[model samples]
Target: MFEGLSHLARDAKAWPFEQARNLLARTLRIRLTDAERDLAVVLINSGKTAEAVATFPALAKPVILETGYGPSGLPHLGTFQEVARTTMVRAAFRSLTDDAVPTRLISFSDDMDGLRKIAPNLPNQAMLAEDMGKPLTVVRDPFGTHESFGAHNNARLQAFLDNFGFDYEFVSSTDCYRGGVFDKTLLVALERFDAIQKVMLPTLGEERRATYSPFLPISPKTGRVLQVPTLERHVDKGTIVFEDEDGTLTEVPVTGGHVKMQWKPDWALRWTALGIDYEMSGKDLIDSVKASNQICKALGGVPPEGFNYELFLDEQGQKISKTKGNGLTMDEWLTFGTPESLAYYIFQSPKSAKRLHRDVVPKAADEYLQQLDAYQRQEPAQQINNPVWHIHGGRPPQEGSPVSFSLLLNLVSAADAQDKAVLWGFLSRYIPGASPETHPLLDTLAGYAVAYYEDQIKPNKAFRAPDEKERAAMLDLRARLAAMPSDCQDAELIQNEVYSAGNDAGFDPLRSWFQALYEVLLGQSQGPRFGSFAAIFGLPRTLALMDEKLGG
Candidate 1:
């Protein structure tokens, strides 16, 4: 009899030595929540424990976490979210443990899934159309890069995951079935077919239930998966008889990769067989999760604890779809923002649906910078909940010179800078001697801001014609800015002068004044803090922008 140990433990240790060393050095106390503590209790209840020490580790057994991606289209931002969020939880788990418990995240790709429709984004749609209803493993890669469409997409997915240096194990459904890794679970599902059907049928439509079988055998004749009605089941022999697509009755062994279960059954069986402790799905799958949980229980296996997160929405509030291509792509996000920003976006309230679009990038990037700043200024206790702490996995990077994305955007706009060196030229004026190497984040933000300004801001550059009172305000602001000592034009002093100029212009200081300033100068209703912009953009250039907007 084979005693089951987590594949993660068999293949890898808890964390590499450096990571373990960093975890031990951290002094910040991260108290586990009741829910997180309960997970440890469940693991102990499952009878996997290490020897008793003065302080108990979180679990005796290695924790198995998984996130599934359907490789039907190119990987996108939504695909990255699941892996990012799961990694964060794994990091949180380390905070509670003595750094002995092993954890692994499975980045499972369901590439064996049948190609039902040609994705709109892929090349060579006609070739894919010919292979419709066949497993993705059998379809030709239109790009001619890999042996099959599934392999090509799998490579793309792996490349994207690797780019982030995600610590995960990759699993392929096709490989799992073909390598007989799922043979035992397949037999169990075949033996309890009727029981699993009872749990699944109520949620499905009558037409679907009428012909549905728990297992789908790939047609030996046509090489397409057949979803016909089951005719007979020989549980003892591990064989199922079903009608093929040609209306011929066929007998196939359930084991040795002859068949795979339908999605809901497969989900439950994978949980049971893999001993997965945690997984997450979009809220739209709530019913499916419920059905799968019941199926797992009927199979005499405990279902993994699950988290249901709200789906990402497009700018118009429609759900982001890989097929629709409505939301930002992984490349687009990385091009315009930092990986840390995307991680921070996923770290926000996981249960809430958030918008992902070009409009949201600057704010997310700036918030990431702000949190990075906080990690330096705040006490260790105060930094626990900060997103940067989680983004960096407990050992937050020591903060450098903090620069906001909005300020960088304005600086780029003011200087018309195209590269980091050009932007650094302007940045050096403010910090006196800083270069891109001394402020890596500011260097990165300079590139992001240049791209963002060209894409998002340049096309919408319509400076409003200020009213008579507003023109007076702009002229007043320009005069005050010109008189300020070049050495004294720090953010705070510059901000105070802007406010005084507004007061001197005779407009309500609180309401219309600053907004009018932004519209005239930046051509946006709001912008980076006027003081910060003035300091970074240089007082001389700031006076020039004011004069240009006022038609001086």
Candidate 2:
């Protein structure tokens, strides 16, 4: 019993890494290997030994970091995924740490790299050189350039940062390394230059050089790799050697390695140099990240912590890429909804899993608002450590009337009580004999409606008023509806009454009335029956809307 008490006490003091399995399952939806679990334990208390552990208590911890985006073309959903993932992980780290310690996030933009032709459909394809070996930031086209392509990519990147509210320090390789931020690491690598050369380039059959070509020339036409001449090494002032055809050896002047450190060594080197703690990269870089681990051991540093997230798939299941031209840009999504909705879409999915297309956004929006509302409504909890809820059962935090753009527009133009149904009437005008209760893209349609009223309706009053012929048609339709039986209750009854009234009034111009209503209500050519819409929007408001159309 005494031993049991001691054992229980010991177990009670176990590290937070013990919770790693549960946390991974709940947060990441991933399972960890035994090795991964063990490493996480060490990682949780990294740099602290058993001695430190005994002397002071600490929580399980992991430094968080992420691969920064490259300043390239408009960032597609995939690039935005990285931003969202990093932001959420930072949030997670804070949650785990009880919001005591600040989490660090690093962003790297490969701006000094040359531009290679990508995405066949990208505009100004000719501007990109056919060389993959060049740094995107280094290459320039014939046009003197409006803004550097690198700068343009940075602008797009900033859009995501602002949209998602990410907290990170941006790093540009051209600037950071050149500014000597990595000078120590570069010098350390130079000291082991011979070791890297042997591994980077080896004799055939002696060993397989795990690294690919490091000094390849960039093909300007095909953007493929081509071995190029060497330059003087700017960092070490040493020269490198190369083997030519027929096994002849030629001494190339020491220049920078012909190619940038292949992604593997570069990954290891950058992490070691910068002491980066974590990086989330694309799935395509999985192999490189693994290879980088091996190189990190060779370079005398631990590999940086990291995770690999999968790419976003389009509706077609193909990877979402800016190059594909099919992926939705951030700008387009923002037009339909707020930024929080976008982040909600990303955070709700596992980073390594693809998100299928679904019409779940409106619900997500409602849910976010609902969560906010619930948070506001909550009284202080008796439990001091209860977890804050991220969402509240997928409902809007607040309530809103199920009003449509057509209603708003009609109200905006209505001159009196008769104009009360003006908006609904205008909206119903867009429907056939029947209108859709829910629009597939109601938000966008609403935006168009608002814009039309603000920019066109108010400014083009003279153009909105129907001439004498249109006035006669509307009056005729109104008279027809008035003559309908008092018992007429259904939509069909109203329609028949308006048609008959039009003929009786000798204005047999129901179609003309519709066209005029469409033009006045939506600034379009044809629309729903004005008479039926006016009945619902209220006859007074409809007529008042007409009055304002002519006079206001």
Candidate 3:
């Protein structure tokens, strides 16, 4: 369906050309996730994007995609997932249009926001406590790495995004408010202050509703962003009168960083000011999105249309908090998981809630490899369905890793391999002619496997002797594998033999059978597919390990 599509992604058969092909194929009817596919069809048909936000919007406007970040704490996995998922949609949109519609992603930092409370994880609590109600842009950098805390966090976010090579423009709320970029929007907000109040007041409690003002002027005396009530609005003068804490009425221009709107209004103001076309947030922000949309309309602008992905949860089902460091950090994942695997995890079930924990890393790594391996054989239709396609922006790595990350961990456990070289030794025998250079993915995985084994697997390993039934099964399985052809490379064939031994030994649930193998052989509660592990780790070696465990 897409003849010249390969030319669009990259004119190469090596993963580079697949994105273009996917896009080129998109000139035809494309089917994907409900929200994305609907958006693409609307844009491709060149219809109104008011409902979806920006398809030939206003005749010549470019497609704009935005993701927001708060500088309250260092960046986390949630932050990375937001950008990665947005970028995936952007790629999908581009594919549907064949790059005819130019799209831009804005990585917005809300530095103008005040730090309500010091995060428990941030250092120098005494210093942060002193700057209580000040805008994050002016708060002293606890890290001593940037001009302010906002700058420090923003820098970390940028570096993190850059590490993943995301295509986005970094925008600071402080810069927009102070540099006259938001001047016109602020004036509109001042003119329609009552309209904004109508949208915001009902959402707040009685106390907040009484003191609520759309415009939060920066305190002249203390340099803090004040949240007092607006006594008067001077739209003609482009200003508002608000009483300071000392009961003194202060009038400040709504322009030039002198005043900032409360958050919901600020969100609407940004949409109006920047003409943002699309933006996505977590489920927790659904009410905020609704309010922003109404406020955006009140300010004579359409709210950007996007979906609300469910919030990520920590292992215990609580919302993942960047400030409290309650879940897996991107840096933590990178320590033992490949970037591709991490991206794949983020790409999966974006609209569904996920449990973010360290244990998910190895599984993610294996799943990503399995998907990448599947991509080469899949047609264009099937390829797009794979997360790797979107994770790599259509251009995934062509070389598939020979060993699964889980299997590698098991192999490391079985061999008691403490180093990469030791793991590589068994891997060399597993896949002849493969080396760290020849299989780059495996090479990356080898390092991660070592780290994961030491931190997550090795210390937790609990090898127990097999029960009477399991012992008989293991010995039979060992005998079967021992008699197999020395040059045997078939994983499923070896796997069948292992299953036969377990079945013949009368393992009713079969799960218990596999569990016994894991406990007795690998010293773990769970492990990779026994057949695959045997094939990869070598049958002879596996049999020897079993004999040792069984006292043969």
Model 2 clash count equals 37
TM-score of each: 0.88, 0.53, 0.88
Q: State the displacement of the C-alpha of residue 179, model 1, in Å, after optimal TM-score superposition.
A: 1.7
All candidates' lDDT scores? Answer: 0.75, 0.49, 0.80
Q: Model 3, 1-552: lDDT tens per residue?
A: 222232233333322234323433332222245556566555544532233334323323466778999998777777888898888877766654455556789999999998898877788999999998899999999989889999999998999889889989999999999999999988988888888889888999998898889889898888899988888988789888888767788888999999888899999999889988778788988999999999999998877767788887889998887557798888888999988888888877777788988999999998989999999998876676678878888788887887889888998898878788888887787787888888877888888998999998888888788878788888788888878896677899998998899889998898888888999988898888899888877777887888888993
RMSD of each: 7.0, 13.1, 5.9
- Model 2 spans > 4 angstroms off: 1-64, 118-134, 141-148, 190-211, 214-239, 242-259, 355-360, 370-552
Model 2: how far is 287 from its true place, Å? Answer: 2.2
In candidate 3, which residue pairs clash? 5-20, 9-20
User: Candidate 1, TM-score vs. the true structure?
Assistant: 0.88
lDDT string, candidate 2, 1-552, tens digits? 011121122122121112322333332212235555455345334432233223323322334465666665556566666766555545444433333333467777766555544655455556564434456555443234434566667656766666555667777766654576655555555556556555555432533443334444333333333354333233445334444433444443222322344445566777777766556677887776766676676678766655666666767778765545555556655544455566656655344555434323344444444444445465423111111222211122343223333444444444222232333344454443433344333333345344445543545543466677666665665555555543343455666665665555455445665566667644555333444455455554554555555453
Off by over 4 Å in 3: 1-60, 120-124, 322-325, 485-493
* Residue 432, candidate 1: C-alpha displacement in angstroms: 2.3
List the lowest-lDDT window of 10 residues for candidate 2. Answer: 1-10
Model 2 per-residue lDDT at 14? 20
Clashes (N, CA, C under 3 Å) per candidate? 0, 37, 2
